[model samples]
Target: MAGLWRKAPSPCIGICKRPGGICVGCGMTKADKKTFKRRRSKGERKALFRILIERLDGMGRLARWEHVYRRRCDRKDRPCPLDKL
Candidate 1:
């Protein structure tokens, strides 16, 4: 079902921290967030999510990111992908 979509939803939680170029809310960097706007295949988006999850874990912020992400999904009336991850 994920592959059926033409564009991937962003993972931002709206809390951007410019000092480190990493979002303290969703754990995505500026570049990482920009990648979602590119013309990437669904599979590529899913792969990117995996890498993002790992990055969050490496920073010991996966739990925080997940919480924020879920809320963001709720606000956007979209399904949360954390279950898929």
Candidate 2:
């Protein structure tokens, strides 16, 4: 069961553009970004990333986010959840 647990990677690509309170870079709101760092629950982080991806997709910025996020995951040595989706 422990093997099933995976660390969730932060979705921040570091652009940090908050247009209408939603980040144009990672699709995370200010609160979401803050909550991400403090979130100990892997499930919560994954869920947040999932929602953010959907939001980015809607905003037509999914490709850019996915590209950078994949690189971030690689640098951190984590499997990108986006690839699995």
Candidate 3:
């Protein structure tokens, strides 16, 4: 007997922004949040997992902010509010 299972997709779009403290595009919780100020390298799965946990713990507030930002960006002929700052 076999059970149905599928691997989740990688959450990396390759754009790294330090200001947001996370990937604004791919929502890569792991690579974006890992503490690597001194070293520039790719994070391992364990480090990424830790970041995922942290993000999940604060998902409500993050999701709300993302929604608000998206709405603000949706206006015609207007740049995203995030872009201005």
lDDT of 1 by residue, 22-49 (tens): 6666667777777676736767777777
Prediction 2 global C-alpha lDDT = 0.77
* CA lDDT, candidate 2, residue 28: 90
Question: Which ten contiguous residues of candidate 1 have the minimum total lDDT?
Answer: 1-10
Sorted on TM-score, best first, the list reads 2, 1, 3
What tens digits encode model 3's per-residue C-alpha lDDT throughout 23-84? 55434545343433322223343354345445634644345444544464453334432332
Candidate 2 lDDT by residue in tens digits, 1-85? 2111255577888899896999999999888877776766556666777798899999999999999888887888876676554
Best by TM-score: 2
Best by lDDT: 2
Better of 1 and 3 by TM-score: 1
TM-score of each: 0.75, 0.81, 0.27
